[model samples]
Target: MKVGLYFGTFNPIHTGHLIIANHMAEYSGLDQIWMVVTPHNPLKKKSTLLEDHHRLQMVFLATEDYPKLKPSDVEFRLPQPNYTVNTLAHLQEKFPTHEFSLIMGEDNLNSLHKWKNYDVLLQNHHIYVYPRISTDKLNPEFENHPKIHMIDAPVVEISSTFIRNGVKEGKNVQPLLPHKVWQYIEHNLFYKK
Candidate 1:
């Protein structure tokens, strides 16, 4: 099976996430799109991140209805400040029969050089990059690279940070989130200050 791994903290999985995953599965020639919930990203701030379990639950709630989209907790057992390279390696070992590809946004591609062992990542795995609005153009070094595939998925500017802020400010965030996810957040009072 060919699986596209879409890694994120998914503090609260939103519609933007589902859209990208669905697009990749339907159009990217992949059998499945796993929304890998990173327990902690090496490059991001941890202060505002929700508990790992809570984030995982939100992902589950958001993705339960989609057969092609799966919620993964692979990074939860891995070390803190989860590095992409290590996770990719471990996943390969754990699921030897399946092929895994990385799914990311254009912004991540621009900053790919900064990731740990990024060279190995590019050389060993396929990458499907979706466009993000207002990000820097794709780096010239990766242009026409055989390993990278640019996907023309719909661009939704909404982000987890925006959702969190809206919830904290008592604004309606229902439109931005999956119905079940919004209900989960409301019942749990996540991000309430």
Candidate 2:
């Protein structure tokens, strides 16, 4: 199967995330879109991110209704602060038959050079880049790269940080999140200081 790995912290999975994932799953050649919940580094325990499992649960709640979108916790078992290349290698070892690709936004594509072992990642896997409301300049090298496919997807600007801040300030951020995910966040009183 052709799978697209969409990595994110997913602190509270929001509607914008679903729109992009669903777009990739339905319009692109990908057979499945896995919202890989990026686990928090144990070394950085005091970080602002929610617990890894909680974020993963939010992803599960958000994606449960979509057949093509699924949640993954592959990073949770890996060593802390793992790189994308390492995850790709591990996934390759775990699922030898499946063709795995990356699903990222335009902003991420611009900073791809800073990633560890990025050369290996570009050579081994394809990248599906979706539009983002980024003011950052694009890297010239990947402008016409064969491994990169620029998807004409909608530009979603809603961010998890925005939702978190809104919730903390007692604003109505419910519309930004998936119904079940919002319920889960509300029930847990997450981000409410």
Candidate 3:
């Protein structure tokens, strides 16, 4: 089975995420799109993040209706300050029968050169790129790279940050989140800081 690893903190999984993941699952020729909930990033403010399990549960609620979309806690067990290459390697090892590819935005593609062991990543798996609204052009090196597949997916402008801020301000962000996910956040008073 082919899977597209859609990694995100999903601080709270919102609709924009679903739009992109659903697009990949339906159009990217991948059988499944795993929404990999990332552990706390050492570089980011840890206080702003929900607990790993909370974030993972929100992802589960968000993706429950989509058969091809799955919520993954694969990174939650890895050491902190994780790298994509490490997660990919671990997933590969644990699911030897599954061929995994990355589902990333075009803007991320522009900075792929900076990721740890990215050359090794390119050599081992295909990257499914979805469009992002960004001023930066995709790096010239990967423009024609066989390992990079530009998927003509929608440019979803909604972001988890936007949803969080909106919720904090008492804005009705319910429409921005999946129903169950929004209910969970509302019930828990998450992001209402």
Q: After TM-score superposition, what is the CA distance of residue 9 in candidate 1 from its true location, in Å? A: 0.9
Task: Give the worst 10-residue stretch by lDDT in candidate 2.
Answer: 39-48
**Candidate 2 lDDT by residue in tens digits, 1-193:** 9999999998778999999999999999999999999988777765559988899999998999999999999999898779999999999999999999999999999999999988999999999999988777789989999999999999898999999899999999988999999999989999997
User: 1-193, model 3: which lDDT tens digit per residue?
Assistant: 9999999989888899999999999998999999999887767877769988999999998888899999999987898788899999998999999999998999889999999999999999999999888888668899899999999999989888899899999899888899999999989999999
For lDDT, the strongest prediction is 2
Candidate 1, residue 36: Cα displacement in angstroms equals 0.8
TM-scores for all candidates: the values are 0.95, 0.97, 0.96
Ordering by TM-score: 2, 3, 1
Q: Candidate 3: deviation at residue 99, Å?
A: 0.5
lDDT of 1 by residue, 1-193 (tens): 9999999989788999999999999999999999999886556777778888889989998989999999999988998767889998999999999989999999888989899999999989999999988647678988999999999999978889999999999999899999988998999888997
- The number of residue pairs in model 2 that clash at the backbone is 0
Alpha-carbon lDDT, every model: 0.91, 0.93, 0.92
- Error in Å for residue 61 of model 1: 0.8
Ranking by lDDT: 2, 3, 1
| Candidate 2 TM-score versus the reference | 0.97
Q: Report the C-alpha displacement of residue 1, candidate 3, in angstroms.
A: 0.4
Q: How close is candidate 3 to the true structure, as a TM-score?
A: 0.96
